[model samples]
Target: MVVVKSVSRHADVASATSELHMESGQIIRYVAPMTLDCAEMNEHQQVVMLAQEKRLLFGDVSEEAEKWAGVSDLCQAMDHIVEIEKETELFKGKRILEVGFCTGLPSVYALEHGAVEATLVCTDNDALNNYIKPTIRKNNVGKLVNYITCDIEQLREKFETNKFDIILAPELVNTKPEYFEQMHDMLKLALAHNGMIFFSGRTHYNSCDGSMSAMLDLMKSKKCFDIMERSTFNNSVRNETAPRKVVQLMHKMC
Candidate 1:
């Protein structure tokens, strides 16, 4: 049997850094502050556990979307978000806009943990819409979250400039390489005074082609935000190809 400990509601920032461990045959489930000994659960059940971990809570999705996104990537992404939150004091009772929150697990986690409210944005899809709306209710965070299915840039009408206390994009930034600059501008507009932008992307240590270093250099030139903290983690899925993952917190300058 594998022993998995759940994070307590009273867990301080120091304790938020606890890592989830999975043995070859053991699965760990984090449903809010409760931890399940998943030894008796099967593969499908394990997927359910992972879905909950990926976002605050995952409602039912069509079998196709579930298989398309896969369990390992979703779980790994959530793990990175968890680590990012741990390293900074960004999420408690603050207004947040989580862009491209696939599975909505991180959104729910932020809301339940202390984020006053979260505006969740993702590409509009019938399957995801059906899954996330119910998931928000099922997780009992409906009052704490607003669901939006539109382009991030179009949020100009939905939210005012300097409105959100924190803006988060776990892995979505790198996926939309074409709109990287536009997305950065959207984040800048959505951020409140002294607000934070927490983002993650694949890093290239030596290559100058669109690496995190190049991105940071560009941001420095813009002089819009100050780099508050940064850390790297081993990519769980692309262990060999994309070994290092870069997560950073930027404070919007006054």
Candidate 2:
């Protein structure tokens, strides 16, 4: 049998990533802030337990999304953003635009963490803009992050073209219903020379075949960017699994 020990809510125990023991041939689900005694596992269950460790073990997406509120257990995402900030030299004097500024988490977190030299344009669907805009201002980052509650399709009405140095599009477009044209347009209009665009999405956001194909094709047609780094980030924690394996996109030759 597997011994499961649960912990307090909204807490993550780093040490819990250790190997787990399976109670039966079937899968045993465990969550964060929990302790497991793996000594009583059969060999097969032990194997399964090991596989489980590879996952994030974070809770349900909706629950966590609400509870964590903003950028919780997203240290890795923040780390990547920080790297981009450093490479682009984004600071109080520079400009950065994040396409899907939900909860303004990445924008505010980025500001609170680094890129203090940047003027951030935190844009999102009009519906959610008000929801997170107040939080953005409340973060005391009003001077750094300017909230714009508009779709990427409506950027020109708000700001001039080539006005930003860094563009971030996290969880913006999914594979279905392809937001490629609109995304491409926004990127072209916003980023200036030496500007870098960062996105975290899945390949299916725009196409049935895959999201990467459309993105690659569009970028190639534009001939304005050099694909820098594209990789998969599997941050799946079960019961709270990510929608899909996230595709990380980076560009420089803009």
TM-scores for every predicted model: 0.59, 0.54
- Scored by TM-score, the top model is 1
Worst window of 10 by summed lDDT in candidate 2: 66-75
Q: Report the error of model 2 at residue 227, Å.
A: 1.2
User: Please, what are the lDDT tens digits per residue for candidate 2 over residues 97-216?
Assistant: 766424444555456545543344443344243334445545567676665545544657665744776666564444343667666776776776666666654334212333545676
lDDT of candidate 2 at residue 191, scale 0 to 100: 74
lDDT of 1 at 5: 37
lDDT of 1 at 203: 53
Residue range 80-185, candidate 1, lDDT tens digits: 4555445324467688787743545556656755788988776757535444565566567878877677665567767664388877665543333455676667
- Top candidate (lDDT): 1
Candidate 1's displacement at residue 197, Å, is 1.5
Q: List clashing residue pairs in candidate 1.
A: 55-105, 55-106, 56-105, 93-114
Off by over 4 Å in 1: 1-89, 151-153, 204-214, 232-239, 244-246, 252-254
